[model samples]
Target chain A: MSAPGQAPSAGYAAVFVHEDVPTAEVDRLEALHRPLADSVRDLVDATIRTTVEDEEVRAVRAEVDALVARLRARQLDGPAGVRYNAEGRTWSWGNAVVGERNAVAPPLEVVRDPDGLVHADTVLGAAYEGPPGMVHGGVGALLLDHVMGVAASAHQRVTLTGTLTMRYVRSTPLGPVRVEARIEREEGRKVFVVATLGDPDGVTVEADGVFIVPRWAV
Target chain B: MSAPGQAPSAGYAAVFVHEDVPTAEVDRLEALHRPLADSVRDLVDATIRTTVEDEEVRAVRAEVDALVARLRARQLDGPAGVRYNAEGRTWSWGNAVVGERNAVAPPLEVVRDPDGLVHADTVLGAAYEGPPGMVHGGVGALLLDHVMGVAASAHQRVTLTGTLTMRYVRSTPLGPVRVEARIEREEGRKVFVVATLGDPDGVTVEADGVFIVPRWAV
Candidate 1:
C-alpha cells in the first residue's frame, strides 16, 4: 500500500489484488482478527464515555501507546487493499463498513438471500451517534452504500458507487438498526439499487444509488 | 446514553445539552483529551496494518483490554451528546464527524471563512479505505454531510440533515482531502447547501443537501 498522501500507481487492477490464499486460511485469519476488532470497538466506546480522572486517562493513554508500538513491530506497508483467492473467496479486512478487522466499522453482518436481496442487522453504538441519540445521517448513508454495493456485486461482479441519494423519512435512533438493499434495475454497466436504513419500528432513511462496473472490471 | 437497543426519550432538546461549564474549563478538558484521541487514531491505523505473530497479537489484545478497563472504571451513563458552555462554546466530544475524543472520526478540523463558507482539510487514512487505496464513497458523504451541516447551522442554529445526494465525479485516493460547503439558500425551516469532497488534484464527490431546523428550535 502507498503511504497515506502518496498516490498509488493509479488503476483498478492495482487496487484489487489476487493473493490466491486458500479459503481455509482466509477463514482462519478472519477468526483471528475479528475478536481483536471487537475489543477495539469496545475500547472506542469506553474512550468516549469514560469519566476516569485525568491521571487515569493519562495512564490509559500510555498503555495504549505501548500496545500500538507492539502492533507496529511488524506491519503492512500500507492499507489492506482488497484481496481475492483462486477459489473465489474475497476478503477486505480493512473495509470501512464491513471489514472484520475494522474496529471503526459498525458490526454489520450482511446476508444475501436467494431472491437477490442484501441485508444486514447491526447495533449502532455511541461511536455511530450523530444527532443526540440518533444515528448520524452520513453513517446511515455509509451502511446503505456498502450493502447496496453488495447487492450490485452479487455473483462476484465488482462495482463502484457512482451516485447515491438519501431521503431522511425520520430520525433513526442509535440502537438496533437494519439495512436492506436490492438491485432495482440495470442499464448496461450501471446497476440501480434501492436500500433502506431503519430501526426496529420502520424505515427511517431510504436510498437509491447507481453502482457502476468500472471499465477495467467489465 | 441509552443502551444499545433501548429507545431514548425523544426530542431535539434531549440531544443538545447545556452544561454552563466555564470556557476556561472546557479548554482545559479539550487539552487533556485531544492527545488521547489522537493516540487512539494512530492505534486504529496500526491495528489495520499490523502483521505480527499470533502470540504477539494475543498479547497486545490483553493489554488493550486492560486499558479499556481502566478507562471504563468510571464513565458517562450514555453517549456524549453535544454540549455547550455558558460562554457559547460548543463541544460534541463524541461527534461522528468532528468529535475531538472520537478515534473513529477522521482528523477533520472544519473552519468557517470570514464570509460564512465552511471548509476543512484532513487526512483520510487506512481506516477509511473503500475501494483499493481509495476513500470509501460513504466516507466522502460523511465528511460532506457534516461540513454542509456546519454551513447550514452557521450562527449557532441547530439543524438536522433532511436529504443528501452525492455524485461521485471521480475516485478519491486515500490521503489528504479537502471538503468545502456553503449555504445555497433557505426557505422557512429548510436550508439548502452545496459541498464538495476532493483530493489535491480536484473534486471527487459533489453534494447538495437539505437541512431542516426542527420545529422545536424554530
Candidate 2:
C-alpha cells in the first residue's frame, strides 16, 4: 500500500485493475481466511477477559512474542489494498469494518439489495463495549458509516465519505443489532445516504451521510 | 460486563464508588500493557499484510493456534467492564479506541483538558485504511465520537451520545491526524460538542454531537 500523502504504489494500483479472478479462488481464499480471523477474534476476547496472575501474564507475553516473530519471519510487502475482479467480486481484507481477515472488526456482514438499500446484522460483544451495558457510541457509528457508505456506492463506483451525522435515540445494548441504509438522493458526484443502527427493540442510532466520488476516482 | 439487555453486574456498581488508586500503580500497569499491545498490533498488521504461500500460511496458523490455546488455558469469567479509582484515574482496557490491549483498535490516545476540551493525535496506518490513501470516513467519525464523548463527560459524570453530525470537508489522508472537541453548550442532561479530525495540512472532517447524561447516571 502507499504511504500517507504518497501516490498509489504498483501493488496498490493492481486493486483497481479489472481482472478476472475465478469465483472458486475467491471463495477458497475467504474460507481459509475466515477461520483464521475467527480464531484471532476469540483470542482478542480471551485476552481482555483473562485475569491470570501477573507471573502467568508475563509468561504468556513471552510466548506470544515468539509466535509473533515466527509469523513475521515471512510477510507481505505492505497493506492489502482493495481488489475486485471483473465478475463484480470486491474484497478488502484490510478494511476496518468488514475485512474478512480483520479480527478487530465486529463480526459484521453487510448486504445491499436491488432497491439500493443496505442491510446488515452483527453482534457487539465485550470487545466492542464502551458503557456499562451498552455498545460504544463510536462502535455504533462505525457500523452505520460502513453500511451507509455501501448504500452510496451501490453502483460499485468508488465513493468516499464526505460527511456523516448520527443521532443516538437510545443506548444500544451489546448483542444482536441490525443496520439499514438507503440512498436519499444524488447530486452530480455526491450521494446522500441515510441509515440506522438498532436492536430488536427498535432504532438506537440514526445517521445521514454525504459520499463523494472523488476527482481521482472519477 | 453485562450481556445484551441485562442489567450491569454488581461489580459495575463499584465504578461509582471511586476509591483512591495511586497514580504510580496506574502508570505502571499502563506501561506493562503498552508493550504487549504494541506487539499484538504488529501481529495484526502482519496477519493482514502477509502474502506467504498457502502451505507456509497453514503451518503458521497451526503455531498460532497453539499459542492461543496456551493463553486460553486460564481466563477471566467475563468482560472487563470500566473501572476507576479515587485518584481520578480511569482505565478501560477493552475500549475500542484507546484500549492498549485491543489489537483491533487503532492506536489512538485521547487527552481531555480542564477547559472541557479534548485533544488527541494518532497515526492511521494500514489497519485503519478506508479509502485509497485516505482515512475511512467511519474511522474519522469513530475517533471524533470517542473524543467528543470524553468532552461531554469531562466533568466525570456519565454521558452517552445522543446525536452526531459530521460534515466531510475533504477526504482525510492516512497518517498523522489530530482531533479536538469541546463542549459547546448544555441543557438539562444534554451537552453539545463540536470537534474536528484533521491533518497538518488542514481540517478534513468536522463534527457536531449531542451527548446525554442518562437518567441512571444522573
Candidate 3:
C-alpha cells in the first residue's frame, strides 16, 4: 500500500489504492463532517425560501462571503482526487451522490444486501424539490443512478454508468422515501441493474441501468 | 392566471401555471443570482478539499453555523412552491435542474430548437467530478434527465420522466459539454426522447427517456 497522498506509478487519477486511514478514524471524521453538512443543507433550504428583506439578504450574503474566505484561507490546490490509505479502505468524501462533505446531496446511507441488492432511505427535503411539493425527477434519477451504480460495482470491481432508463411511476413527494437497486445481469464488461424509488405509499420511480467496466478500470 | 404564490388548485402540486414575472425581471434576477451561486459552488469545492487542522475546521464550522443562523433568522415557513404570475412566462428558481437559486445545479441554459429539439451547454467543474477528473456518472444522468424531460414537455404540455435509460459511452471529463434531446416518438401519454452528452471531442453519454403526461396533466 502506498502512503497517504502518494499515488502509485500508474497515475494520480487512475491509482485506486487498496488502503486508507483506520476504519475507526474514518468513521470519526464522517461523524464530524455530517452535522456540518446538515447545517449547510439547512442553509440551502433556508436560502431558497427566505423572504428576508432585500437589504437583509444582501447583509447575510456578505457575512457568508466572509465565512467562505476564512475557510478558503487554507485548502487543497485542486480536486480531492480519490484517496485510499494503507488500511485498504477507500474514501471519496467529495462524491456528489455520497460525499460526506456535500450538503447538496441528500442524507443518503446505502446498504448492500447479502444478496447484492443495494438500498437506501432518505428524506428529500425542500432542497431537493422540483415541481411544487414533489421531489425533482432528476434528483430521483440521481439517487437511483448512484445506488444502481453501486449495485453494478459490487465485489470491488469498478463500473461506470453507461446508460440508465428511469420510469416515474408517480411524482415522489418531498419526504421520506426508499431507493433500491439490484444487478439484473452482466455481459462481459456491461453490468445491468434494476432499481426503484418509493414513498411509503408505493414505488414512484423505476430505473434500469447499464454500467460498464471502463477500460482503465479493467 | 392567478396572483403570485396562488395556485390554480387542481391540487397545488399538479398545476403548472403558464405565467410569471416579465422576461426582463426574470433575466435580471438570474444575472443577480449567478455570482452568488458561483461563489457557493466554490465554497462547496473548497470545503471538500480543505486540509486545515481539525481545530480550524471546527472553528470554520462554527463561523459557518453563525452565518446559517443569521440567514435562517427570517425565512419562509416551507418549501418554495412553484409560482407564476400572468406574464405568460414561468420560472421555478429552485428547480433541481435549472433553478437559478440552486447552487448545486450546473448553470445550464437549455434552448429548444425550432424543430422541437432541446439542447443546453454548461461546464462541469470540480464540484461535479466523480471519477478522478471526470464528471460524475450520476451528474451526467442528471443533465440528460432534465434535457430529455424538457424534450418530452415541449409545446406547452407538461410531462414527467416516466422511464429514462442512459448509456455512458465514455468518461466525460470536467469541462464544457453540450447536451441535446429530442422527441423520438409519442404514444398517448408517453413521450419518448433521445439525448446525448458530449465534450468537444465527441459524445460521451447517450440517453433515451420515457416521459408521461399524468392523468392530472391531461
- Interface DockQ per candidate: 0.54, 0.44, 0.46
Q: Top model by DockQ, which number?
A: 1
Candidate 2's residue-wise lDDT over A1-218, tens digit each? 11121233343464443437886798898887766667667767766766556666677677667766766677656566676675667677777788777676765688878877789998888778776546778888878888887788776566767778887787787889999999999998888898889999999888888887766655
Worst 10 residues of 2 chain A by lDDT: A1-10
Model 3 gets an lDDT of 0.72
Model 1 lDDT tens row, A27-66: 9888887878888888889988998899988888888888
Query: TM-score of B chain for each model?
Result: 0.92, 0.85, 0.84
What's the lDDT for residue B126 in model 3?
Answer: 65
Per-candidate total of colliding backbone pairs: 1, 5, 19
Best by lDDT: 1
Candidate 1 lDDT for residue B45:
84
lDDT of 3 by residue, B1-218 (tens): 01122233354545454544687876776566555556666667667767666776787678667766776787767666676756555667677777767667775778988999889999876677676667777788778877777777787666666667777787788889999999999898888889999999999988887777666757
Question: Order of candidates by DockQ, top first?
Answer: 1, 3, 2
| Residue A101 lDDT in candidate 3 | 81
Candidate 3 fraction of reference contacts recovered: 0.54
Candidate 2 lDDT (Cα, whole model)? 0.72
Q: For model 3, what TM-score does chain A reach?
A: 0.87
Q: Give the range of the ten consecutive residues with the poorest summed lDDT in model 3 chain B.
A: B1-10
